[model samples]
Target: LSLSGFINIYLQKTFVSKQLSNLLINGVQPPPLPSKKKVVVDFSSPNIAKEMHVGHLRSTIIGDSMCRLFEFLGYEVLRLNHVGDWGTQFGMLIAHLQDMFPDYLTVSPPIGDLQAFYKFQKIYDCLDIKLIERGESYYQDQMVEVVKEFEKKGLVELDEGRKVVFPPGQPIPLTVVKSDGGYTYDTSDLAAIRQRIFEEKADIIIYVTDSGQSTHFQVVFAAVQLIGWYDPKVIRVEHAGFGVVLGEDK
Candidate 1:
């Protein structure tokens, strides 16, 4: 399209959008002008043992900007880094430590390059099926120990075979243990959500992600609703999704 045509189309679209906004606002019973609102945001949660990539960088920058915007608007903003600090990655890491270098697992940060250690462990396991099984077994045992520790403190419970419990309808679940007696990401996330809400008193949970993740967020919110953690009529989950940041192909 020519420059004049593009400019004309842009103006027309902008005018239409403004008109739609005006119509909607005028048609609805508007809430009182903005007051104190609690906003919680989840971002930059990369999985354990995974390299942080461009996507994570985008989440960090965007989430920080959003939190700043809300803070400037006078809302109580809680920035949450839902770190992938639990589950299966630890399975492999712990297994390799126990099997190969049994002495170093207990050593403080004084001795080994932990990152390099995990890297080598991954390489070794990839080349050995027996090591894979051992890793799986170790993961299961570690999950049990973690669950037991939480259960002792009355923080976690095992249900059915492995389901754990959170408040019903709140998008949380009872992730006791997996069918393989392993701890799943869903289970660990359940713990994290519970801690964030009950311990931290988060009033809202906002997830910022690519628009493609909307379904994932929707299902999670539905689970929370079904599990009884949220009241659809009052509290809710919002996805601040954006389109892909595109550039010309190489």
Candidate 2:
């Protein structure tokens, strides 16, 4: 057979125009993933009482992009906005509010009007991004259980009156409970990760934050692995970190 004969046979078998029309209409199909996995992406974590800055914007956009990609790839994606709505700072704010407004219980406080003024949800709405707000306060009640579990597994130790856990090969110890019997970021993160794995049934968990928090998430993931919560080989955990956005002056 000659080149002309091979070309004639190929043209007869394949419909070139039809294939092009299909490509244009339906677009390209991406390869199937290994399995239908659930992905939980935590991002756009702006703190309470603070304005949303460039860092939060970057994280939100990046995380939403990843969620869209995963959804396109046939994965169940859960977009989470882990806001900083708990801590000692809130206690101080509450105390100040109470002091300023003595009859706060009987009458509506003036500050109540501003509650919706600086909400991060407004920004999400403007961007047309969907996210569930599960802040640190959501895991406040569960922190005690996390500490109990850590104590049960002998993963926690009393270091200078603070309950801390030292991940394997880590130089710094994670302070889960402070000396004042208050839960820290480590405790809430541990609780959140466990909830995402056990309750939410997430096969992959991705946290989008600034690069400065890379070590924090690393330590949290390591501690979770040490607790035997989830097998690293089975579940995928990642921290998608971005660089800091500096001001013009800096």
Candidate 3:
């Protein structure tokens, strides 16, 4: 036999021996090849006081699959459920709670069932998906700082008394703050992205939602790029948007 043929046989035997050793030692489990990068996935963001619909379920499953894949690749994954826990609607709920229980501040009211936020936790547990709850309300205070950052960078423009940020190439500007001084979804998303980048130190950020919100996230991502939050070349930020789930009425 030639020298090249002998070398090929030896290499094939070595590969087979390694596979046999791995099978005996680790069974069906694959060895972990650790990576340094961190990934943050935002998904299953159902609003507080609302039931989990098919859209939320689809996002949850898809996001969990992505997280598993990342983990298998040894990338650090932060699973986030960015629930809609704040806004004008919550303000009305708070007012009603205060009226029902005058000492709401001192004594915890039994508003758990009414809020319906914890109900989703059970579903998540059943799905065996681990996630950290970082709702919009968590960044309510940080939204002010977000607006300040935009203003400091001279990216914000006053459009008829509302604070808006117009991303390059986008015709409509994102309303970060309304004329009534209330923060919109744009403000919360900005704060969340900043936190994930600067605080969470995520090398990659993925937002999983329905296709209907594709433009909204595109605008938010563009605004973040404009604000100099993270270099697009170094950090990967994307929207894993899926098709909308419609009823059979149509």
Q: Estimate each model's TM-score.
A: 0.55, 0.88, 0.82
Q: Worst lDDT window (10 residues) for model 2? A: 4-13
Clashes of 2: 0
In candidate 3, residue 149 scores what lDDT?
88
* Best first by TM-score, ranked: 2, 3, 1
lDDT of each: 0.58, 0.87, 0.87
Cα deviation of 28 in candidate 3 (Å)? 6.4
lDDT of 1 by residue, 1-250 (tens): 6555343433688889988898888764435535577777876454546655455556656777877776666777777655544456766767866777667746643434546443533432543311111122223334455466546656555566665645434444545567677666554444445444555566667777788767555655654554455576666567888776565771
How does candidate 2 score on lDDT? 0.87
Judged by whole-model lDDT over C-alpha atoms, candidate 3 comes out at 0.87
CA lDDT of 228 in candidate 3? 87
Clashes of each: 24, 0, 0
> How good is model 2 by TM-score?
0.88
lDDT of 2 at 29: 77
Model 1 worst lDDT window (10 residues): 129-138
**Which scores greater on TM-score, model 1 or model 3?**
3
